[model samples]
Target chain A: MPSATMLPITDVSACCTNVTRETISAENAELLARSLKALADPARLRLISIVAASEGAEACVCDLTEPLGLSQPTVSHHLKVLVDAGYLEREKRGTWAYYRLTPGSLDAVSSLLATV
Target chain B: MPSATMLPITDVSACCTNVTRETISAENAELLARSLKALADPARLRLISIVAASEGAEACVCDLTEPLGLSQPTVSHHLKVLVDAGYLEREKRGTWAYYRLTPGSLDAVSSLLATV
Candidate 1:
């Protein structure tokens, strides 16, 4: 079952196959494409990097705007997208939300692409 | 220098960094995003898998249409996108065009994502 974040790639990867090993089903292709679409943007990719490189592989939403050179709302929007796509996990502490790389999520997608 | 195919991700990776190691530059983010955009479509993903799973990791354009259940032009367009993004290499043999995975291209992108 998918978490509340609804990671479609995680659901699809349960089958343990990759594009290069066999022809993927349309359903799996759609799900994987959705995840790729989430990461296919410049801002989102940058956001992921910033969060990953930060201490503890996490960063406060408050700290994201300056490095991305984007406004707070825009950075929040990208953060939301990453959270929704299951690449990042979000937790609230006091006045701010912090984001961290969801362990192995990137590697799962990486394995898919490398085999292709 | 970029190839005629203009693999921007390859050009960017020449800098010898992955996103997790540091904040990626805006220009590098843009180029990587462009390559990911080419791969963010379901049809294109399926097209790549079919081609990769074919003999010698290559497939003739003639053999692609049926498995994809897409028209020739539609499949051709997706292939063109993959070729332009440097994910696939196109070759002409007599009357038919063949496509094969460009060596190390997917792995390059994979390395970036996994490290992030």
Candidate 2:
């Protein structure tokens, strides 16, 4: 069953069979690749981790710049890619933009790699 | 708990907390990123999936070229990256090389992305 935290995934299959269970279709492979590509960078992963681990599982653009030790623009760029990839959710709050983990997004991709 | 299928991961933390649970260190993020980078390609994911689904959870370079719709050299290159990343294992089989999922390698990574 799909977890309650799982959001609607447009490009990839939901609860799709993983690599261990059966051969994945090419289309599904492409979608999965796109999602994984967004997470392929160390900077992006750090950004995600920071936001995910932040209080309320969310963080503001202002707060992320310091711990990430990256330029504001660079952090924003990574966040944008993550949002576009559907792994994150972005919201505007006053002068800053807040990003949050998109519920089951990471879990969905993780499950795809399951070998058991 | 780490599954029996999970293999030993040298670079990253074992049963380490994910981003959802806490902020990840840069070093861990880099290691995770490297692992994810290896799986960020459609061809690679397809390759992994195909190998995992094959009988005995293994495949030869010869059998992979056709379904992947890529040249032998291309397939071989991707396989090498996966092996280096520790997701797949390569073994000599007389005339050809057989590749198989490295037991817990994929699951260890999948567990890393767990949000719950």
Candidate 3:
């Protein structure tokens, strides 16, 4: 195996092909579909919004549950999905877990949808 | 019932609340979620890309099935979902139905995802 320093760094939120400008390959389409699926839920959307609207665009699990009207377990599950999909980053600070938008993640997806 | 002339015009692609700038209301989250659901499938995403890359950013139903490698009926179903979700508009020409991206639909979603 190559050393860590020899490995190429990949940007998870790197820009994708503009869907309107050209035909996206099957692989790219599948990847994008998965990302969109992670985001295509009302609860998850609200969670992201709440976290985004919080101080410094970050929030703890304790703060999210009440605003979303979702139980802690359910909220944690959605947070996991977002983190797995590269849309959010999770951190454990002492006891509660904090979540924040992954830099450039939403913009990369937004750029893909841009027609012009 | 209101008179035809008195009916309000609704822009299907109207801008939604910025998810990163503020907390999105439940109603708005539901609406946006529905739109994203319609776009969260690989076949449907590929279908959109193919049509958007076609001449004049439009394509006939006949041209879509082949690239998607899906049967005509399946492709038609996906097209219908996109059209119903306001991402594409369909027009029946004598022999076939043509589809094109609805102006501002993608951009509206893009704008919602813009953090800045």
True contacts kept of each: 0.85, 0.88, 0.88
lDDT of 3 by residue, B28-111 (tens): 787778778888898999988888888888899889988889999999899888877778888988998899887777877777
Which one wins on lDDT? 1
1 versus 2: better DockQ goes to? 1
> Candidate 3, which CAPRI tier?
medium
User: Can you tell me the CAPRI class of model 1?
Assistant: medium
Candidate 1 — which pairs collide?
Answer: none
Model 3's C-alpha root-mean-square deviation from the true structure amounts to 5.6
Q: Give the Å error, residue A64, model 3.
A: 1.0
Cα-based TM-score, every candidate: 0.89, 0.88, 0.88
On TM-score, the candidate that comes out on top is 1
Q: Model 1: iRMSD?
A: 1.6
For residues A1-116, could you state the per-residue lDDT of candidate 2 as single tens digits? Answer: 12233223433646456766778888777777777888888888888888877888889988989988999999888888888888888889888788988878877777777665
Off by over 4 Å in 1: A1-8, B1-8
lDDT of 3 at A76: 91
When sorted by DockQ, best at the front, the candidate numbers are 3, 1, 2
User: What tens-digit string does per-residue lDDT give for candidate 2 at B1-116?
Assistant: 22232223533547455755677888777777877888888899999888977988889999999998999999999998888887888999899999998878887888888776
True contacts kept of 3: 0.88
Writing each residue's lDDT as its tens digit, candidate 1 over A1-116 gives 24533465555566537777788898778888878998899999999888888988889987888878899999888888878777889989999889998887788887888864
True-vs-predicted CA distance for residue A44, candidate 1, Å: 0.7
The TM-score of predicted model 2 comes to 0.88
